[model samples]
Target: MENLQMLMYGFTVALSLENISAAIFGAVLGLIVGALPGIGSLAGVALLLPLTYKFNPTTAIIMLGSLYYANMFGGAFSAILINIPGDGPAVMTTLDGFPMAQKGRPGQALFTSNIASFIGGLIGMFIVIFTGPSLARLGLNFGPVEMAALLLLAMTSIGWLLGENPIKGIVTTAMGMLIATMGMDAVRGVPRYYFGSIYLMGGVPFVPLVIGMVGFSRVIGLMTDRKSAPPITERLHYRDCMLTAHDFKRLLMPSIRAGLIGTFIGILPGAGATTAAFVCYAFEKRFKSEEPLGTGAIEGIAACESGNNAAAAGAFAPLLALGIPGSGTGAVLLGGLMMWGLNPGPLLFTNHPDFAWGLLASLFLANLITLAISWVVIPILVQVLTVPIALMIPVIMTICVVGSYSVTNSMYGVLIMFIAGIIGYIMTELKYPTSTLVLAVVLSPIFETDLRRAFLISGGSPAIFFQKPISCVLMIAFFIFLALPIIKAMWKRMRSSKGGV
Candidate 1:
């Protein structure tokens, strides 16, 4: 009943014309950014953050949220048409989406992707509306120990999930952690890694590093690929992209299931859309026994699209509940919240019910708006792919440089972006996953500060990590996550030996 009332209040706030308009604009821009390589929703939101400083808190949040979902939609465009993934989550879509496009059904592929995204988004929104308060309360209970363990779990993700080479992921994570230490020590107030440079006093700026790592790195990589292929010139047919009844029947169940899975994963802090999409793809492969998933299966496309979009909505849950960001894009939204002189969390619901609820309510309208726009413009959007690399690279580079500078207007930002670009380029060549490295970069600062704080508060005792039941449980969970794969591998080896004997 309380939830219902909060949602009702939220709807009232979201109904305003200004908020509505922001959602549409954000969704559209996000789509365009997501369609292009090297310009993901993370970069898109980071770039646009400056513009939102002028808007009201509600309007800024609505716009930022819309952009997030729109990016999810746009990611499908590259995955289907160019066999490229603009974001980590979209990688799953390329497995089947590209093949579907090549099979002369590009229109159908677009249709399913949009519809699946819509369905997934709705599911995630439903969860937010109905269970958000409870989730928020749970989030509030998390302490530094639990947070540390959670971050540790997130760090291990690099090793276990990023690529075939676990060592590279571990090395990348360590490098990020080490770099995060450059700022003043949270406990001692002495700068450890700044190396006496005044510019390093405040530490590496996050926006520049991220923009460089995720955006400029791709620009550099694409620079080398420009000579290998001519520009894409395939035109899209908008009228044919509408879903048929048959297509709807085939997509509905998978879309719904994927959305549910994605939303659940999103609610779990640090599990973003990328993980959701990957899990959905694996689920599709495992359960759909007779069907080959990576071979243009419609189910695969549905799973990828639905899971990623739903995860976008799920990412918001933490922001609303605990004032913590669950993804990099969520971090940008956090900045917007700070800019507006409005903070998120449980107190927000009490002091600013309209603001909190309104943001949540805006999502429903945003999803519908995205679906409508995608349906009408998908065919036209195809032309974006044909943009020549020479033209596109410079434009993207301009945006990257500007975005980095705008974060704090520091010249070192541009330098960091360039340095990150070089690092990114080298990492890519070495078969390292940028996602893992970026994740570590984003989380390591918070992890280091909090870990040090927790230790200081506990009089330098490591056992403080286990003093709280929640933290102990989380520590146990971390060990379990670490052991699962090793145990399975050992079990498989033993079974093989027994069979051979």
Candidate 2:
């Protein structure tokens, strides 16, 4: 009942005219950005972060939250109409969504995605609304040791889940940590890797690096690919907007289950929409005997769409409850919060009830706007898939450049974007997953800060990691995730030997 009252308050805050406008704007912008290949929500949010400085806390949050959900709506375009995924989370959608599109049912595929996403996002939002205060109460007990362990666990998951090889993932994580250490140490007031250079003193610019690796890199790769492909018009048909009763019945359970899975994963650091989507896909394959996956199964669509959108909503849990960002997009949102001179976490609700409640309220409105717009625009949105890759690459590059430069108005950032684009292209050629590298970059800084704090609090004793039950359990979990691949490989070899004998 208390939770219900709080939700009512949140709704009241979110339903205001200004917040509604913000949601609409954010949704529109997010859709446009999410439609572009390789741009993704992280890049979109990073580009928009600077603008948050100009708005109130509630307004800024409404905008960012809308963008987060809107990206899911827009991401389906490329997945169904084209084989390319608009964002990382949408990659799973492509596996089945593209196949559905190829069968001349693009509208049906997209409709499933939007509806499932809306359902999932709403479920996640409710989970947060009801469970957040309790979670925040628990998070209050987290000390440096717990934070260190949590970060370690998260990094391990990211390292394992984002790529086939954990070694490369770890290496990328280490590189990001090194980059994060370049700025002046907050505790010591001394720079570690600046080399007496003025620009180095401030550390690597996060927005530039994020845009460079995520946005510009895709541009370079696409430009190279454009040399051989003949231009073709993307054709989309909107013959179907409503799902049959059978289709709805078939998808409901999976969407709900996926929403739960996605929300749970979203609350944890290092787990984001892509991981949620994959996990939900695996779960669907295991549980749904009637629906074979990876073949345009409605279950597949429900799982991927719900899981990804739920993950977006779930990503807010840590941010609102504990001030930890669950993913790169979370980081941008967190920065926006701080930019408004508003700090998030347990006290945020107490000190700024309007801001906190208002933001949560706006989520419902945002999801509604997303669903309505996506439903209405499915046909035209599908036409976006027909854009020539050659023509689109230049425009994408321009957006990337502008976004990167907007981060700090530094020419050096543009240079960084170009350079990172080259590095990203090279990594792609080597079959190294960019997701692993980008996630590593996002988490390394937090891991370093917390690790250092943990060591300091424990008088430099390593045993501090295992002193608490939660910390100890998380550390063990991290080790298991790190070891699974190696163990599986050895098991394979042993089985082969036994068979030969």
Tens digits of lDDT, candidate 2, 1-501 = 776787689778888777788899898778877876656887777666655556677887898899888998788777766677788899999888878767767777888888899999999999988767776777778887887787677666776666666666766666666777887886678877989878779877766776777667767777766755333265544557578888788788889999999999988777889889989888888776345777777788889899989988987877787676777677667756764677776677677777777887788889989998887776666556556777878777887788778776888778877777788778767766565555555556556777888998888998988878999998889889878867876888899999999
Q: RMSD of each candidate?
A: 3.9, 3.3
The most accurate candidate by TM-score is 2
Candidate 1, TM-score vs. the true structure?
0.86
| Candidate 2 runs further than 4 Å off | 48-53, 227-239, 286-293, 335-346, 433-447, 485-501
Model 1: weakest 10-residue lDDT segment is: 157-166
lDDT of each candidate versus the true structure: 0.78, 0.77
Worst 10 residues of 2 by lDDT: 228-237
lDDT of 2 at 10: 78
The global Cα lDDT (0 to 1) of model 1 is 0.78
